[model samples]
Target: MFLTPAERIADYQARGWWEEIGVDALLRQAVAERGATLALVDPLNRKTLDGCAPERLSWNELDARVDAMAAALIALGLERDDVICAQLPNTVDAVILFLAVARLGLIISPIVMQYREHELGHILSLTDARAFVTVPTFHGHDYAAMAAALIAERPGMMLLTMGAAPHGADLRALAASADPASVAPWCAAHPVAGGEVLTICWTSGTEARPKGVPRDHNHWVLNAKVIVWGTGMQPGDVLLNPFPLVNIASIGGLMLPWLEVRGTMVLHHPFDLSVFLKQIEAEHVTYTIAPPAVLTALLKQPQIAASVDLSSLRAIGSGSAPLTPWLIEGWAETHGIEICNIFGSNEGMALMSSPIDVPDRTERAHYFPRFGAEGVDWDSPVSAVMRTRLVDPETGAIITEPGRPGEMHISGGTVISGYWRSPELNGASFDGEWFRTGDLFEIAGDGALSRFYRFVGRSKEIIVRGGVNISPAEIDELLVSLPGVREAASVGIPDSDLGERIAVAVVVDDGITPPDVAAVGAHLAAAGVAVFKRPERLVVLSALPRNAMNKVVRADLRAAVLAALES
Candidate 1:
């Protein structure tokens, strides 16, 4: 359970970059000081999303829920170091589950609601989780049934559903039966430490099965600290979180930061623009994160954007890439809201382009503050502890000059030591002390501006559509498995509104009936692929372009598909 080395923990703690208090402690502090303040919220359309009414909980209310859930979990015979898999919508209940696990020294690996059996099976096998927590139904999907079938495969693994379930345990009923006051003794006896692993978030790359990324309490808290320092978040600031709370984009960036600042968290699962704007206006939100494409599309519609009052909002964060200079300036000039560019991954690659650092809206749209640079000081606290160097992927030579694209080597207090239990992946991912971020970046600007890092592209062939990372290899492998498909390649097509959309090109066998777009979509659907990962466009090719290794040339396929779609 102790993933970080003792020396590194001591080193970071001595440097004053990471705190001794864990997330559980942070929640306790918030409950102690801000007991009467509103601290958590359910999505506005909670009844439609999960068949439950919306909830607004103060700090004490949230604390009581956490205690009740923890006590219920303990009564069910769960113990320390047990891994729990959670698949729920963004709601107050989800946040309570997260805290309950942290309080009991348990590791929670949260997956997005989009995941089906194809994803859950692999995660359950990897974590060997003791339990699964989700609603009985979400978006009309029978999640309770899915959990029932999956849990049956592994004997002794329990299923806990938020709503009533015929086949599994009811989480709400269990919490209602348990006494919250009985949990304090158990928590004190268990004593969760800052270095113990708190969460194992999954990420996909070239591998078909997702890789588990384990983060200890100190690491996640440190990740949140970077967000707090960059944004200048103060106590009582309201945060509207629209991203999935599963990964770094939501958890590390917004959730933990909300705990740090003792603010009210407005939960939203994204893509509901009207509800999002409503929550912002109603909560008088001070900060929120949104996708660049969504923000851009909204900006184009002046009337829709004008419908809500965003005067309380000071700044908004959008994650890496797709941020045009005009997009940043448009929001600022029109609404007095600053758009901050955030560069990070679940593996703990952290960078932020805040107004205080870049000042110029144009530069802030594209560049992130280069942390840990010598002789170049930054206002952010993360800048002092992080060490970054751009290295040529082929030659292993470090590139310090501007305009050259190279793989980023990041070493810091919060960077993960390695992936969860994958020795081969760890060997490939970590170079001594530094984690190799497959995303390519360049050093930009002159003099003071030279302290900024610009994102050019990613070395990995992962398609990011609507801020969700999808591995093209997974799509390609699935496509080639279907009948008549001899070779298949998937690539991201640029979109004005979606950042990118999946496009596929297939070469069918001779004399075999070639599948059309509809047929291809049907095949993916039958295989339990997530809707977002399915191809938006499909093209038939006699032969896919390839190099000497015989691997499909994705670049060539992408160009052909783009032309075909345009035509």
Candidate 2:
């Protein structure tokens, strides 16, 4: 048993696998692995991004800063199990805040920067965050104003600001003056236990209220290591992440993997095509994840044909929006770079592919990992660390035979146990021990997963057109690719012939509008989408409405589509 367990661990490690280092230990390891390595880089402004030009930190420097921030928070009377909320973009301060909170064993609940009074208030109140961190202003909105509004509701909350100090908030100046040696001793005094909750993730409230996802140091560290191994990450690789640091994509996509591999990350503030392409060239980025919207804009830019030397890029991954097969094949043939797609949710389940795993356009468009890659066949030894399964959606029973479509359930070291404080969801979220992935899928006979696992759409958002289910994501992907359309969203409107008719809400690019319903139909027909899946009507919108996290408010759009039909 000793040798077998050791062999199992060794197998995983060779593939960049780890059991569970936990959050506290994860930071410790990053400090120890290559203390002198440049863990993060921002080319936009080296000084602000890295602290100074040639701005680099050894493990000692990062550890010291984490300690100082931890001690400072403790000095401010923050205790174990307390929650500190941060509302900021992808900045050095936000990184420091997470490390500091982890050292003190305080839960770090980070909300997106775009969140206003309403969304901000709900998260703050729900977490009962004792302290808050923010930037004075970003883009065009007043962060201080929003923070102040929330603070008024929760008078006991402590407010901390970055960049500029607001009237009612404490400045960040004192943190720099604090001693790191003292903070290290403080971390030693209050060590983070294995099962302690380190962060709270909010689920997308598409159908119901958003539930808080509480993850502990152990689960987070384990998940990060799993992601690193699964995605085939390594040292010296540069990862460009357009998703804000607050999202789960940031947590699993860049932070953990880069830290574990002792790699570099080129952090971008916002997704700007020119800036993004320039950074990829300048920093020699090897990996990145952007929404399909970003990719569409990049291809349209004329400068891409001449100025961009994209040889350094190895793999490009996309999510947060469905990626079409057309986009995947077009980019690969054009740039000679592999485009991979990932399916992930906040429910602690994710499936990611590598350049090798998804070599062609079809794989990039549709393949998702099947469950029980290892646990299913004991006779056959499997090397992959994570295992997946397909099961009946209604009964939650395991599906043994192939060619049957069912929901995907994944179990491995990375899957989280349950949502924070939501006992009601636990039963539905898990099957025995595997995290029940909400995605519906069908595993092929050869044990090789297809590039296209049918989304079957969201449970509530599924369009029942004459009793045949139609996923909005499927239609939305096709609609967005049309000429003159910047982006598209679909919802099911009432219908007499069919149960529901597909209604499309689209944002047309400059000097473009939806032609006639017949014109739209003709375009879909050209694209090879089934006639039934095509939207019967199109509504032009200035922009698709998004929540604080940049997720489309599909429910709200459905309501609008219904109203438009009635009107």
**Per-prediction TM-score:** 0.97, 0.74
Best by TM-score: 1
Residue 357 CA displacement from its true place in model 1, Å: 0.8
Candidate 2 colliding pairs: 35-58, 35-59, 366-451, 366-452, 367-450, 367-451, 367-452, 371-388, 371-389, 372-388
Per-residue lDDT of model 1, residues 528-554, tens digit only: 777888888888777788899988677
lDDT score at residue 229, model 2, on the 0-100 scale: 57
Write out the backbone clash pairs for model 1.
none
Q: lDDT of each prediction vs. the true structure?
A: 0.86, 0.66
Which has the greatest lDDT?
1
Model 2 quality (TM-score): 0.74
